[model samples]
Target: MEFDYVIVGGGSAGCVMAARLAENPRLKICLVEAGGSGRQLAIRMPLGVAGTVPAFPFFRFANWAYETEPQAGLNGRRGYQPRGRCLGGSSAINAMLYTRGHPSDYDGWAARGCTGWGWEDVLPWFRFSERNERGTDAYHGFSGVLQVGDQKQPRSMSKAFIAAAREAGYPLNDDFNGRVQEGVGLYQVTQFFDGKKRGERCSVAAAYLHPRLDWPNLHVITHAHATRILFENSRATGLEFRRNGTNRIVKARAEVILCAGVFGSPQLLKLSGIGPADELSRHGIPVLSNVPQVGENLQDHVDFVMNFRTSSTESVGYGFRGGWRLATEAVKWWRTGEGLCATPAAEAGGFLKSHPELDVPDLQLHFTVGIVDDHSRKFHPGYGYSAHVCVLRPHSRGSVMLGSADAADAPRIDPRFLSDERDALTLIRGAEILQTIMRASTMAPYDKGEIHGQDRMRGAELMDAIRSRADTIYHPVGTCRMGSDAVSVVDPMLRLRGAENVRIVDASVMPSLIGGNTNAPTVMIAEKIAGEMKYNL
Candidate 1:
C-alpha cells in the first residue's frame, strides 16, 4: 500500500495529523492503529474511565496498562503505566482536565534554542484546537475541534476540596489555564455539553478524527500493529505492520510520522535499527544509525495519592447509601444527561508551588470523589474521597530499553521513579501541604479518617509511604527529546535527527514533561507540527 503520508499509531497526535493533512485533497493519508476505533461505550462515557483506564489483559480495551521495571527508589516495586491504545489515546481514559502548563514551560523550550516554541509562538496553535465552553478568551478558543467545558455536576467533595484549599490560605483562581497557574480551583474539563454527545467524553479522536473518517483522502486502518519502520538508507520510507496474522507494508511517498507515543515510538525506532548501537547489537539487531539517545530521557510525574474515607454519601463508593445513589445517578444520566456517570470522577485540581518563593508551581493536585487505590484496580467497601499531589517537574529521569529485538516484545521500561532526591523532597513537602489542607475546617465534615498512608504524616514515615506506594500519574514523555543538539532524537522542527522524512508528533518528543496532565500539551504539539507542515514548513 502506498500513501503520501503514513501516520503510525492512530492515537491523539496521529488523529490530529491525519485530519489536518487530509484537508489538502492532493495528499493521501493512511492512519494505522494497533487498537480498535475509539467508539466503545466505555470510551464515550465520562465515568467509563473506570472501565477503560484499567486496560488490557484484564479489561480488554482502551488502555495499554504496562508496568515498569522494578525501581530501587520505590522500594523495589514495579510502577504501572497506563496509556490509551485506542484512536483517542489517553484523552479517552484521562480525567479530562484541560490544563496548559505555565506559559514559561513553552518559553523555556524557546530559551533552550527550540526556535518556534516560545509561549507567544505556540499559543495560537492551542487556541486553534480548543473550543472552550465558556467561549473564546485570551487563553482559550471557542471555535475548534476539541471541546472544553465544565462538568455537568461535580460532587460535593470536589467543591469542598476548593474550599479546603482556600481555608488553608491559598488563593482561588477559576482558571488554571488562564494568566496565573498557581492557585486552587475546579479544572475546566474536555467534555461535551451540547447536542447528541452532551455529557460525553470529548477525546481527541472524537474531536478530530471521527468526523473526518468519510473524507476520500483519509484512510484509517485499525488493529494494525506496527512492527518497524522500513528505511531507505537513513530516511524512513514507510512502515511494516501486522493485522490479524498477515504482515503488510505501507509505503510513504512523502513522509512517515510516528505518533505511537513514548514507549511505542522509541521501541519501534530501536526495532528498526535506529537506537543505541551497543544495546541493538546485544539484541542481535543491526545498527542503522547508532542514535544513543533514542530511548533515553524518560520523564514522568512522580505521583503520590492519599485516600480518605468519608462518613457521608457525598463521595463515591459502595455502601448502602452510596449504592442507591449510584443506581439513581445511572438513571439520571440516562434520562437527563447529568449525574455521576456524566463526569470524570476527578473533577477538581490545582497547581501550587512546593516553595512559596518559586516563580512557577512545581506540584500539581487532583481531587477525586472516589477512593482511588492502585488506579482503582483495588477497591474497598465504603465511600470516600481522595487527593493526589504529584511532583510536576521531577528532577529524576529514566529510560525505555528493548527487552529483545522482536517487535512483539514489550519494551523494558524503567521510569526510575523518585530516583532523584529533589523529586522526593518536593513530593514529601507537597504531602505535608495536602495534609494541612485536609486539616482545614472545610474538609473536616467529610473526613471519616485516613485510609491509605494513615498516620504516616511525618518526615521519614511520609518518605517511606511515598517510596512504598508512589507511582506514575500517567504523564510520560521525553523518550525522544526534540532539541537543537546532536544527541537529541528529533530537532526543534520535530524531524528525526538521523532520518529524513520522519517526524515525531507525540509526547515522547518533549524535551521535558509539562507541569500538568500531558494530554493537552501533547495535542498542542500535534497541532503546531501539522500547522507548520501546512502553512510554514
Candidate 2:
C-alpha cells in the first residue's frame, strides 16, 4: 500500500504529525504503531500513571518495559526504562506536568548549529500547539491542540512541600513556564479540565489524533512492527513491517518521518543500516550510511529519590486506610472529576540551581505524595512522601547499540549515569536541600521520620549512599541529535545526512538535554516540522 506520508511510531510526535498533515484533506497519511489503540480507561485517567509508569508484567500492556545494562555507578544494578508503547507514548504514562524547560535550552540548540530552533524562533510553535486552561497569554495559548491546566484537588502534603521550601529561603514561583524557570512551586499539568473539577489526562493522542480519527486523509494502523526502512540506495522510499508474522511494505510517496522516540528511533535506524559502520558490521548488517553519532551522546536525568514516612493520611500510601480512601476517590472522580484520582501523584516540583552563583537552574526536583522507591516498583507498607532530585544536564554520556540484527530484540542501553564527578556532587547538595525542606517547620506536623536518610553521613559515606540510590528519571535524550556539524546524526532541518526523504521529529533529535520534562518539547518539535512540511508543500 502507499500513502503521501508513512509516519512510524504513533507516539507524541507521530500523533501531532498525522493530525496536522491530515488537515490538508488532499494529503494521505498513514500512522503505524506497534502497540494497541490508546483508548483504554487507564490511559485517560490521570492517576493511572501508577500502573503504567512502573510497568509490572501484568500491567505493562501500554508500556515498553525496557531495562538498561548494569551501571557501574549505581552499584552494578540494571535500571528500568518504561517507555509508553501505545499511541500517545510516554505522555499517556508520565506525570502530567506541562513544562517547556528553560528558554535557554532551545537557544542552546540553535547555538549548536540548529538555525531555527532558538527560543524566539520556536516559541510560536509551542504556543500554537498549547490549549492551556489558564487562558491565553504571551507565553501560553488558549485554542490549541494540547490542553494544560491546574490540578483540581492536590494533596495537602504537596502544598506543605512548597511551604517548607519557601520557609527554607527558596522563593515561590507562580508559573514555572513563565518568564523565569527558576524557583519552587506547584506545577501546571497537561489535563483536559472543564468548569470546576479536575480532568483526565490530555495525552497527545487524546488532544491531537483522537479528535481527528475520522478525518478522510488520516489512517492509523496498530500492531504493525516496523522491521526496516525500505531504502532505494540513499533514499528512504518506504517501510518494511511485520503483522501477524507476515512481512508487508507500506510505500511512502512523499517522505518517511520517524517518531519512535530516543531508544526506538535509533534502534530502527541501526537495524535498517543507518548507524555506525562498526556497529552495523558487528550485527551482520551492511551499513547504508556511516553515521557514527546515530546512537552516541546519550544523556538522561539521574534522580536520587528520598523517602520519608508521614503520619498524615493526606500523603499516598498502600494500606487499609489508603485503599479505602482510593475507593471513595474513584467515586468522586467519576461523579465530578475531583479527588486523588485526578492527581498526578508527582503533583509539585521546581527548577533550581545547585550553587547560588550559577546562571540557569542546574537541578530539577519532583515532590511525590507517595513513596516512590525503585520507580515505584518496590512497595512499602504505610504512608509516606518522596522528594526526587535530578541533575538537569549530566556530564556523563552513554550509547545505544544493536543487541542483535533483529528488530524484535531491544537495544543495548547504557546512560553511564554519575560517571562524571560533577553530577554526584550536585545531587549530594540537592539532597541536602530536599532533606532541609522535609525537616522544616512547615512539615513538622506531618513528618514522622526518614525512610532513607543521609542526615548523619557526610563526604564519602554520603557519596556511597548517592551511588547506591541514583537512577534515571526517564528523560533519556540526545541519541540522534540534530546539528549542522559532521558528527551529528541529523541536520538543522532534522534530515539525516547522506540520506533523502527521511526526517526525525522526537526527543532523539535534541542537540542537548533540556532542563525539565521533555513531553512538551517533543510535541513542539512535531508542530514545527509539520508546519515546515505544510509550508513547503
Each prediction's Cα RMSD? 1.4, 1.4
The 0-to-1 C-alpha lDDT of every candidate, in the order given, reads 0.88, 0.88
Q: Candidate 1 lDDT, tens digit per residue, 1-537?
A: 899999998888988999999998989999999989898877887877776776635456778778899999999998888888889888878888898888989988888878899999888989999998989989889889899998768778888899999988888989898889999988888888788888888999999999999999999999989999999888888999999989999999989999999999999999999889999999999888989999999999988888888877766787788778878977778677788888888888899998999999999999988888888877788888789999989889999999887777789899888888998899999999988888788888888888865434799989989888889888999999999987889999899987789998999999888888888988999999998898853
Q: Put down candidate 2 lDDT per residue, 16-101, tens digits, no spaces.
A: 99999999988999999998888787877788888889986766889998999999988898988989999999988999889988
Runs of candidate 2 exceeding 4 Å displacement:
195-198
Candidate 2, overall lDDT?
0.88
Clashes of 2: 0
Clashing pairs in 2: none
Clashes of each: 0, 0
Worst 10 residues of 2 by lDDT: 192-201
